[model samples]
Target: MIRSTFVRTALCALLAPTLSCNMLDVNDNEDVSGRGARVFDPYQSSDSGAIRLSLQQFNGCAILPSGSAVSKGTLNLPGYPDTCPDLLAADPTSARSAPTGTLRLMAGTRYFLNQLTLSDIVLNKHTNGADLTDAVRWMKNESRFRNLDWSDLGRVSDQWTFSTGIEGFSQDAWTREVLFDNARWRTVKDDTFTVEIIDQDGVTPRMTPVVYSRTDFLADSAYGGHTRVGWRMETVQAPQSPGDVVPHPLPVLSGQPASPPAYRTLVKIEMVGSTNPFKTFEAPFIPGPAILKVTWSQLPDEPFFFPIELVTPEGLAPTCANADGQPVACGFGVDPKFKFSTPANGQGYYEPGESFRLFLDMRDGDGNQMLPAGVLPSGKDMLADKANGLLYATQASYFTLLERDSLPAYMVAGPLQKLQVRSDPQAKAPYWSANAESVGLVDSLATLSAFPGVYGSTWTTRYSVNLPQDAEPGTYVALVKTQRYFLGERVAKTNSYFFQVGQQEPTTYPNAVGNCQLCHRGVLSLDNLRHGLGVDHVEACKTCHQRDSDLVPRIQTLIHQLHNSSPRYTQNKTDCTVCHLTKESALRPSMNVCQSCHPSVHGDEYFATQFSAKGEPNRFGNCAQTCHAQSTTNGHILPEN
Candidate 1:
């Protein structure tokens, strides 16, 4: 009995002391209380109980879970020996495959009894700076291994045998593929149940560190001279029953010398973030004999941004709002001028006779309002003039309109001057005062009154055009615009406000956008040069165009100068049709209009004796005599002869 107790105690202390000492406490009654008894059962674990695990990770990137992979090239510490050496004992030339790169993992060690089990390894992830990879970033309050894959790679014993491959150094071309993939680039991943070990007692274990370079190695403090996980048993628990004097299959059948339960551990992993944008995949594994830690790797976040809103308040500005043309909060005229949009459906019933504020909002493709300029200084007046007046030049606003017609000459018209407004996206419209559907879709007007908001600013520049009570009864469109001049000359968004008088009209400003955009295409914001004046869907020039008696800029000439009169408009421009918004024949009002271009075609000096077939005096030269300068008749106006 004495010998049996000694042998069992020795074995228990050698292999697993946690459960080793408690195995003998099955007695119903005993005075073993004074025998220095402390219960530690590795096999039993519960939430908020004993038998806890503590994982200490070395490198920030190393605590990653298996199946964690890196990309195309390898990342090696300077002067470190190359990876994957002597990986093939079966090779004739004994070639060692270079690792694409190295990956880190949550690992721990135990050398108590020369027996290492999952229970011995407490992934010390609970420590500070445990994880650095984007795949996993745990904060102070959150660090608990919830999903773990525990593997029991047999045991390493006090014996000897070394030829080619060691215990857990899983290698081969196949292993390389498993580690990275066929894409032989220097890519790597934490795909294996990779384990690197060093005896806590300083006694060398098994396997060997794969080496191609002999200089330096992994920066992990614990990863200095370690070998891959490889175990060979020096001693294993005998399957015999402890009470039996003779060994028999009976104890084996009864499951003597039971192993500890597998640890279902919790490991934090971030699947995607930063440069590593990878899709998720699973690693192959066999069920081990313990439960402890849980592993996690989640998807990364997406492109993020916040846009600005322009505020345009209706009616006269509040007395305080007139911040000496400086940026005040506009209608609110105070702080918290920072505003988001209100998603709305129905705006008020607007008619020509009624007056209202002109407003607008600029957004990204998602319709999310964006801050077009720098953020205002904490207490800066958003309603006051910013940057001594011209800072708003960056996000400046221009108003224009086009007259709508039945079979119209143009689609829209005029920077209709018939309303007043305060500049502020947060400012409200009396007609649009109804509760909004959602928020953040700002139909607003914003300014760079606040310092550092943007290179430019835009405010509520309103007009009070009297829609003649007797004016033509039809619909008109007003286009609210913010030209991207200071940076790139591009229109930020398309916001057109429409109102009707009697009925809605259909108008076609054929190819206005197509033609005008040709020369107006570049957005050069960095320079001071003024590019072509930008045109929006709202041809607001019609408001001023109604009284054009001079042809110095027949509307066509007005547009010509806007383009800096690029040859596309003159010099090489011979086609009059390019500027006309009409049927070819309808363009000619009379012969006098033609004389402007073909002045030589008419004159008393040139056609003094000329007369038509009738014996009357000819007021102007005939098409053949003056209009067609060619010796022969010009194209189709005159006969071929």
Candidate 2:
């Protein structure tokens, strides 16, 4: 009998295209509705007195005629286990009432529904009883309507109220607070009783009153104070479903991708001086100056590839100019003051993101060499600490030697000593010059080097060369060299700077106008239902739909006057959608799909609304009658001939 029933059902399905179910649940008792059938016990074995069907015959069922004979041996229904779990029937009574107050809804449900209803009520009241079809149309077009879920509504501040009791006898307490502790409710209007009920016990029940309130939906708060950018809500938790894991593993490699070869640029050089005559000279043999130390710190994050070549300028040899302005040329002696070039070469490559240092050695005119006092000789390399109170060094090789015998030695010294004395009665000499300027080293060097035939007085100057957009991405070493003139030759070659250049990503909408998405994307948290002059729609429209020169001043004055007028004024509206639409509608205004009621506020009208098109009307009659009727003479009256 069951096999015959299955055959009959299959024939009915094939002959009448109205039936949609692929499997029938014979064990279930639920009535089939229209052409739909309830599938029950779909896993029953064919040999257990059920339909013993062959795969080929079953597949050909749709092609067979209603009265055709079934080839019993060829008919087959594969024994594959069902992938879908059995679905339980929903309670009829439970379906009539709203789902549990605790049931969370998808975002934007409460806001969209509330706004739609409120807009309808406000429009009807202002339009002198105009039908609510337009308002309904707008709500249906809203983007959030389709995506809303139960959880979203549950999160609304005051989304609950009392309705009739389930059995029609008792009073049901349906406060939103009972459903959600955090929910808040604000009464929009006084409660009104809608219907009375009678219970199964034949007792009469009092009528229940209906009330309305708007919900405070949760929104992302991180961008609350940023008026120029828009923010969207994101889920804080990942999906807990077991099947959500990725099946494929991420690729792993041992090394980074090969980058293009790095280019080289020169960094600057620094020179330092050792002991002075006061610290090194004895009673008879006048001690010359000490050693000059030169060092340089490579750019912060550049790779060093080439040797730093220090090229000293021609003949103006390195010399010490004493207080009497006489030059003492200290040649290749243990601490000669004359300048010499040093080649900077090292084997190791500088890491792409690390900083390094380079150092140069030189002697003073009197052949006195300076001992490395800090990190250099000790190999501690503390050069990165700029505030460590160590000796100051510069790119240029410069220094001065003062007479240690001078105490005001000018008055007591002999003629030959005086000729070589180099004393400045008004000047305290080299060491004192260090204290004369705010920029300690630069100023001191400039001051001490004011003497004739002396070139060790000042440090080299540096200038920055800005990088262009098309410049290569890899690091380029920049070397700065400067020269100083002594009696005749360029004695010093100074070098400084190790740095990297970063490229900025190009903008996709470089010419985009005002931050329209700031409010349009629902990031501003304003009352979505409130119609206003500066709402997202109007703000976006103003981007391209600017008024003409002749009309701009007038429109501006009119708009400002309208919004600032008396609150009771009937015609005081300035919303921009009154005259715009996807296409013109006989009953209501549209801004095209772009300016449609929701989803996106941009569409075809965006291109058409440009100032060059001059498409928008100049006068405010239509807009005032629709959205700004409150500012009109009759306040809420529709236009009359």
Q: Give the lowest summed-lDDT range of ten residues in model 1.
A: 171-180
How many residue pairs clash (N, CA or C atoms closer than 3 angstroms) in each of the candidate models, in the order given?
Answer: 107, 71
Q: Per-residue CA lDDT of candidate 2, range 1-641, in tens? A: 01113443345334432222211222311222111112211111111111111000011111010111122121122321112111011111111221111101111111111110000001111121113233323223331121112121121111111122213222222211101111111111221111111221223221221121211222111111100011111111111232222112112323423221111111111111111101111111112211111111111121111101111223223243333445533221121111111111121122222222322223322322222221111101111111111122211111001001100000100111011101111222111100111212122222122222222332222211223333332212222221211111111221211122221111011111222222222312111111111121121212111222211112222233323332322332433222222111212222221121121323223322311112233121134345534553232222221
Error of 2 at 425 (Å): 88
In lDDT terms, how accurate is model 1? Answer: 0.22
Q: Candidate 2, overall lDDT? A: 0.19
In the range 253-300, model 1's lDDT, one tens digit per residue, is: 232342221111122121110011011111111122111112111111
- Misplaced by over 4 Å in model 2 are 1-505, 511-641
Alpha carbon lDDT at 577, candidate 2: 28
TM-score of each: 0.24, 0.13
Error of 1 at 418 (Å): 18
